[model samples]
Target: MKILLIEDDLDLGNGVRIALADHGFDVVWVRQQEDALRQLDTGACELVLLDLGLPDGDGMRILVRLRHERQNLPVIILSARDALEDRLRGLDGGADDYLVKPFVLAELLSRVKALARRSYGFDGDMLEVRGLTLHVPTRRVMIGERTVELTASEYALLKLLMVRADRVVTRRLLEDEALPGAHENASNALDVHMGNLRRKIGEGFVRTVRGVGYVVDTAAPYKVGE
Candidate 1:
C-alpha cells in the first residue's frame, strides 16, 4: 500500500517513513503543505498520515480541502492536539482515524492496517481482477499457480493499476504514485517497469491507450497467446 505522509518534523517523519517502508509500504513523505496537497492531487496515495501542524499552512486546511475533494480517501491525523474537541473535529471532518504524537510506532501501524483492511475491501485485503490476485497485507501478487516476485516499484505500479482497474490511469498519475521521485532517473522508467510487469503477469491484462495511459481491464483474459 502507498501512504502519503504530510509532516514537517524531521526526526518523526524519517522514523515513520522508515518504519512504513520496512513493513512493505510505499511512503511518500513531504514536509510542506503545498507539496502534500500536490501529492494528494495525483491520487497516488491510498492512505494519508496528515500532521495538523505544518510550516507553510495549517494541516486542518489541507484536511478540509481533502474532504471537499476526495470524500472517501482515508486520512489519519497525527497531531499533538489531544483535546476532545480536536479529535471530534477531526473525525467530523472526515478523518478515518487520529493518532496523537509521541505515540508508539506499533500503534500507528496497527491503525494503518485496520484502516487499510476496512477501506480497501473484501477477500481479506486481496485485490483480484481476472486471475491476478494482489494480497495487500503481504504485498504478494499471484497469477494462477505462479507467484510473481516484484520489486517495490513494480509492486506499487501494479497495485495502483489494479486498484483503479478498468479505468485509464494517466502516465503522470502513475509516476507520482508508484515511482515517486523516479522521474529524474530516466524518461522511460515507468515504461521499463510496466513492460516487466506485463511480461511477468502475462499479456492482455494491461492495455496501452497510446498517448493517454494504461488500464487494467477486468474483463480481459488472463493470458493471450503470442
Candidate 2:
C-alpha cells in the first residue's frame, strides 16, 4: 500500500525507503512537515511513518492536525525519541505504532502489515492454508515439513496472493501493492519476481491465469504433469 514517510535524515530516510520498497510498499517520502501535511491533506496515502523532527517544525504539529482531521489514519512514529514520556506522547497523540531508531527493517515491515491487516478485520499474526504457513510477526514462511526462505519482495507477493486466496489477484493490483513505485514501471520486473517465487516454493504453490492475473487456490489440486 502507499505510505507517507516523513523523515528528515538523508541516511535514515533513504535506508527506510529502500527497505520498505524491498518489502513492497509504495513510499512517498518527505523531509519537511509542510510537505507531509500536503500529502496527508490529499488523503491518498494509506499509512504514515512519521519522525518527530522536521525542518519546518516539530512533526507533532502535523500529528496533531492529523488526529484532528483523520482520526482513523494509521500513523507509526519512527523516531530517535526513546524517553518514556516521548513514547507515551506519541501513542497518546494518535500514533498507531512506534519504532525507535536503530530498529530492524523486518520488524518495521511486520508492524505495517499487522496494522494494515487489522484494519481489514484480520486479527492474527499468521496466515495458513493447508501446510503452507506465514508468520506475520516474524516474517517466516514454512511448508508442510520444511522451512522456506523468501526475499522481502517474494514474501510480500506471497502474502498478497495467500490472503486473497480463492480469487484472482489482478496484475495491476499486484504491481501496485508488491512492486516499488519506480520498479513497477519496468515491464519485466513482475515476471522476474514471480519466476523466482515459483522456483523457490515449487510451481504448484501458485497458479497463473494467462492474461488475467495470478491465483493461490487453496483447494486447487496439484496437476499431474506440472
Candidate 3:
C-alpha cells in the first residue's frame, strides 16, 4: 500500500521511509505541510503518517483541513509532543493513531497494519484468502477443516504474502519484514521457510516470480498436486 509520510526531521524521515519500504509499503515522504497537502490533493496515498511540527505550519491544521476534505482517509500522527492534551487533540482532530517520538519501529508497523485492516475493511482478527485462514491474534493457520502448524518465520512469511494476496511481494521486502535477522549473511532462510510453507499449505497457491519475489493468487484454482 502507498503511504504519505510527512516528517521534517531528516534522520527520522529517512529511517521511517527505509523501514516502511522494507515492509513493502510505497512511501511518498514530504518534509513540509504544503507538500503534504498537495500530495493529498492528488489522492495518491492510501494512508498518511503525519508529523505535528513542520517548517511552514503545524500538522494539526493539516489534519483539520484533511478531515474537512477527506473524512475517511486514514491518518496517523507521529510527533514528539506527548502531553495528554496533545494526544487528545490529535485523536479528536481526526487522527486515527497517535505515536510519540522515540518509539519502536515494530510498534509503528503494528499500528499501521491495524489501521490498514480497519480502513480496508478487513475481517478484524481474521485474514482469509481462498480456503486458507490466518487468525491474526493467535497466529493460527487453517486450511479447510485441518490446522497447519508453521514455524515462526514461516508463519510471518505466509501471513504477509496472504495479507497481500495477488500482489508480488518482493524478495527484499519478504526478507526484511518476515525473516528479519535470518535474512542477513546472505542465507537462504527465506527460501527455506517459503518452501516449508508451500509444502504445508499445498502447492500452486503461491507462484514464484523468478528472481523478483512471490505472489499468492487467491483467484487461481489450487489443485492438490499439479
Candidate 4:
C-alpha cells in the first residue's frame, strides 16, 4: 500500500514515515501544503494521512481542495486537535477517520486497515495469492503449512505483484512504488529481490513478461504458459 503523509513536524513525520514503511507502506512525506498537492497530483497514493497544521497554509484548506479534486480519496486526519468540535468538524469535512497525536501506532495501523477495506475492499492484514498467504501486519508469508521467510525488499516486490495480480505492472511503476528512493540502483536491485522471492515461493508464482514487468495469478496456480 502507498500512503501520503502530510505532517510538518520533522521528528513526527520521519518517525511515522519509517513506521509505515516497516509495515509495508510506500510513504510519500511532504511538510508543506503545496508539496502535498504536488504529491497528490501524481495520483499514486492509495490513502492519505493529513495533518491540520502546516507551515505554508492551513491543512484544512488543503483538505477542502483535496475533497474537491479527488472526491473519493480516503483521508485520515492526524492532528493534535482532540476536542469534540474539532473531531466532528474534520469528520464533517469529508475525512474518513481522525486520529489525534500522541496516539498508538497500532491503533493508527488498525484504522488504516479499516479505511483500506472500506475504500478498496483490500483484505485487512491479509492478502492471498493462490495458496500463498501474506499477513501484512506481521510481514509473514505462508505457503500451505510452511512459513516462507523473505527479505524486506523481496516482500515488497511480492506484495506489489500480488496486489495487482492478473494485471501487467510496468517496470517504472515497480521502481517508483515497490522500490521508492532507490532508483539509482533499482534495476539490478529489483532483479535480485524478484529472483529471491520466486525461489522462496515457486518459480511459477510470479510471471515475468519480457521487457515489461512481473505479475501474479491470484485466482489459481500461476503458470507462465497459461
Query: Using TM-score as the measure, which candidate wins?
Result: 1
RMSD of each: 4.8, 8.2, 9.6, 5.0
Model 2 lDDT tens row, 1-226: 5679999999989988998777656689999988998888766576899999788898888889989998877899998999999999999999999899979987888888888676532223666776788876678898877899999889989888876666677777777767867244668778888999988888677889999889987775766798
- Give the alpha carbon lDDT tens digit for every residue of 104-202 in model 4: 888888888788766654544677766888888788999999999988778878777765566667777777777876566645767777887889997
Give the per-residue Cα lDDT of candidate 3 at 97.
94
TM-score for each prediction?
0.73, 0.55, 0.57, 0.64
Report how far residue 9 has shifted in candidate 1, in Å.
2.1
* Residue 65 CA displacement from its true place in model 3, Å: 1.1
Better of 3 and 4 by lDDT: 3
Question: Which residue pairs show collisions in model 3?
Answer: none
| Candidate 1 per-residue lDDT over residues 75-115, each given as its tens digit | 99999999999999999988999899899998898888788
Off by over 4 Å in 3: 121-226
In candidate 4, what residue range of length 10 has the lowest lDDT sum?
117-126
lDDT of 2: 0.81
Query: Model 1 clash tally?
Result: 0
Model 2, residue 154: what's the lDDT? 90
Which numbered prediction scores highest in lDDT against the true structure?
A: 1
Q: What is the lDDT of candidate 3?
A: 0.84
Error of 1 at 31 (Å): 2.2
Q: What lDDT tens digits, residue by residue, belong to model 3 across residues 94-181?
A: 9999999989988898898789777652333567877888876577899989999999888888877876677678888888767777
